[model samples]
Target chain A: MKTTPLAALHESLGARMLPFAGWEMPIQYQGIVAEHKAVRESVGIFDISHMGQFYASGNSVADWLNSLLTNDTGKLGDGEGQYTLLLNEKGGVIDDMIIYRISADEFFLVVNAARIDEDWAWFQKHCPADITLRNESDHFAGVAVQGPKAKAAWKAVFPDCDLPEKNGILEKDDWVVCRTGYTGEDGFEFFSPADQIETWFQNFLDAGAQPCGLGARDSLRLEKCFPLNGSDLNESNTPLEAGLGFFVKLDKGCDFTGSDVLQKQKSKGLKQKLVALKATGKGPPPRGGYDIALPGGEIIGQLTSGGQSPVLACGIGMAYVPIELADLGTEIEVVVRDRRYPLEVVKKPFV
Target chain B: MNVPDHLKYTESHEWIDGSEVVTVGISDHAQEELTDVVYLELPEIGRTVKKGEAIAVIESVKAANDIYAPVSGEIVEINEPLGEAPEPVNNDPFGDGWMFKIKTSNASEIDELLNADAYRQLIS
Candidate 1:
């Protein structure tokens, strides 16, 4: 049970604590559905301190990173970030990350909490002599202030420091702010020294931001069809299979790790794809690992992430099925607790 | 944490009223803990179940919860509307949120359940 820098603050607020990614993170404060609705309609703040942070700098840092990650670092301007993936030799996703070009010769990466050690280890094993890599996961705490009013919340806290534009990063003394979030809302991620994160979290709350938890965060992202690294993505699945091929650049003028396999998969046609599913009839909400079957009860795959959408008031989820059965409007049944429920394959961004 | 004096409770958080044919529902403390009640499944009207057996299920936004049989009995009726909209489970767990009614096979089994005071202490 690793604790975040603001563990005590979460406890004081009557948050339901749960173990996630090896951290005793808050599952909810007021309630998951209430907190979820708060983020969709208003502003909500979340503790994202458990995620990993890394800094890389070198003479040809852009080229070096392009050789290691799926997205081309050359495409990023200074202070710009893009969604990207790190892949193993077989094109299986190691982790999905947001890599930013801090400057011409430097870059910063934010990665999943559970993959911190593994991502850091992968970077170390492939480090070229020219590049300097630093794992700063233990030194920083992060918060995501999200929703339509996110900018107002940010303005209330750091009025002197202008918030960056979308997918942009701005760094100050011992702190960094990025216009990024998984909730599909207007938001920014604030990363500061671990000791000062509590103060910053409180400031946002004082500015009328609702303090949310991981439960709401999961539902919010799922509603938007954001693929969680360990759930929709895995060691055996490629980003291409997860419908994240937009981030993998095969024609970036240089080949990177797992690029060859991705090129092959692209040319030969994909075998499976991650697609969204919605319950067609009323029943229990679809959840992860629930079997997805044809109308006749032939199992094809299982849901990777799912829950009832608070906004839509219907069961929604994502699943990886064979490409043949992954088209929009494909009829599927999700077996929940030994009984099949009517489900339909649908388009993403379910909200 | 509201435990009505007339209702009997189980450690699993179900509440029962009546002696022969009882109305069963989840406790307030239970519903409060399992917030955001989304959807639920009720056992068939004629299904017989044993005491402490998981006979029904409730799904919240976070996870699914099993609703157990308070005593060995046959289910006489189910709250079917909950299968569509489950907000009542969180809003009014004891009244409209009542899950089912059972015809007790053994009346003596009801005596072993907790009273309002004991249920309160169990949650606290």
Candidate 2:
């Protein structure tokens, strides 16, 4: 299995190791709940080096990106980024990504770790001869330092460098910093050369950032209602149905890969909707594949992503249910083992 | 790693003490491996089971692990407090963390369990 540069460090710190998306990664350090609370209360650092990075540059790079991604690239000024989706011809999400316009003719795209190979192949297959796209997945190591204390920690490490505003990117010789993160907290993501990432990680640790793992990362992101690709998102569901229509600009005046299907779906209507669910009573944490039901106890669907909310002290999850039953405050039930528990359709960001 | 000298262990990491009314709990190694004990689903008292039957569940933050019956018998008691506060499983797996007490139907099953030394080697 592939391992990150901090494998030895994680072992030394006695982190619980698990296999995720074919990578041997640290699932938790001190503990999942503790690390999660650290990120919520103070500062925490996570190794996101496994995610794929691509640099695209050309005289017409903006137009090329606009032709493929769902978000409108024409609105992105230099140093700005936005959450976007790459869709198939059927309007199904292939992979969600963040593309940052580095310059008028250059952009940097960060894709999901599990979708690296497929995304690279898709980009290469669609690239124009004049446009240059370079895959830099293995060249960089990523660290996301997040929490209320994140700005103070970043200041401690780079006293002279001013942090970019929200959704902003900053480029240096060996490091690229972005004011973005999965957790709904104030933070910045720093990407540096693979060999030099350890130094940055250690520096963040010294600046009082607790080392977190995938477990806490998932919990934090779930609390914020961020859809995880390959789980809450897949190639079968359109962005409009997944409650991500904000990222899909149908009125951009340009056609993307799935623009036609998206237009038709908008004109028609969504049959299913992705909505958040929270357990109303005590029970075992609702997990993925647990069956969900309607108000009358008719089984409808299975949860795509579910877990115990370390902050909320209950089970929370997301699932695609019939549009009529997706309204907030709709009473529902999620079956754990053989018994069902009270579940309610809730607003995004369960916290 | 802390395999108590007096406790007999099962291959699944549970520890049983006393032959007639045995107190059962997970080993220290098991709790350490399952960090952040968040929630637990305990079996009802008076439930009778056979050897190796899964009777309860222990949930960490991310996953659920089953707690099996080492020897078939009737469950006379359970760690009811764990429903609200499960950290004792991680803090004191052998003492305050005991899951249940089973009144064994066959005392011979006790001899089939591994001794402290043998259980230590299984984990090692």
Candidate 3:
């Protein structure tokens, strides 16, 4: 298994290590709930170095990217980043990513950890010969500093560096700092050389940022209703059905992969939609493969990801349900073992 | 991890104290591993349970674990406050976080369980 540059530091901090996306990574430092609360109330740092990074540079980079991704890359100004999806011919999402426009001809992409090889192969197949596509997944490390006090924490570490605005990217030396995160908080993701990542992580810790891990990361993202790549999204599912249509550009003037299918689905509407479900009564928290049913016990769907929401203090999860049953406030049941617990379809970002 | 000297423990991480109506709860080591207890499902009063049978369900932030009965008995009472708030199981697993009381006259069964030193060795 791959280990991040800061794996030693994580061990020194007594983090519980677990295997994630082919990497041996820390799952929690103190505990998931405590680290989760630190991110919500103060500041927390996550070593996300396991994720994939790539650089695309060429004269026709914007035009090529616009045709390759679901979002309109032509709309991204320099120093801007947009959440986009890479889809297959059938409009099924291959991976979701944040594409940063560094300059007129240079763009940086961050893809999911497990999909790096697949995404690389896909890019190579369609990329123009003149375009320079470099996969820098092994050379760099990434860390996310998140929470209400994230800006203050950053200021303490890099006093002279100005934090970027929301969805903005700032290039400094070999690092690319972006104002984006999976957790619903004011935070920044720093991409730096692997050798210097430990120093940066330590500096953030000295600045009062709690060291967190993947366990907290999952809970925090789920609370914000952010769809995970493998759990809530896959090649078998489209962005529209996953409730991520806002990021898909149907009429961007370029026919990117899956555009036609997505356009048709948008116009005709969807048969099933991903909806957030909150446990209404105290019971075992819904988990993946748990059955979603009506009060009469007819199964409709299954949870993609489910767990106890540390902030909400109750069980929360996401599941794909029929369009009619996806409405907010709709009552449902989640079957755990032989018993069914009352659940309700509600809006996202349960926190 | 705290393991009360007077309490009898099971290899599965449960503790039983008192004689006739024994108070039962998970050990501190078990609570530490299952961080941040969120919800629990307690067995109903008057429910008859066999030794080693799962009598309760505990849900932490990441996963859920079953709590087994330390010995055969009828459940006399359950910690009602845990239904609304389960943090005590993480905060005070030995005291305020006691799960249920089982009415059993089987002193020999209790003696068969591990003592504090034996339980500590099992966990280590």
Lowest summed-lDDT stretch of 10 residues in model 3 chain B? Answer: B103-112
Candidate number of the best DockQ: 1
**Tens digit of lDDT per residue, candidate 1, span A45-146?**
999999999999999889999998998887889999999999999999899999999999999999999999999999999999999999999999999999
lDDT of 2 by residue, B1-124 (tens): 6789999999999999999999999999999888878888888999998889999899988799999999989999998998888889999999999999999999999999999999999999
Mind giving the per-residue lDDT tens digits that candidate 1 earns over B3-61? 89999999999999999999999999899889889888899999999999999988889
Q: DockQ ranking from best to worst?
A: 1, 2, 3
Q: How many residue pairs clash in each candidate?
A: 0, 0, 0
Which wins on DockQ, candidate 1 or candidate 3? 1
TM-score of structure candidate 2: 0.97
**TM-score to native of every candidate shown:** 0.98, 0.97, 0.94
User: Candidate 2's residue-wise lDDT over A238-298, tens digit each?
Assistant: 9999999999998887899999999999999999999999999888899988999875568
TM-score of the A-chain for all models = 0.99, 0.98, 0.98
- Tens digit of lDDT per residue, candidate 3, span B25-66? 999999988888888899999999888899899988878899
* lDDT pick, better of 2 and 3: 2
**Which digits, one per residue and each the tens of the lDDT, describe model 3 over residues A295-320?**
97689878998888888878899998
**Which of the numbered candidates is closest to the native, going by highest TM-score?**
1
Backbone clash tally (model 1)? 0
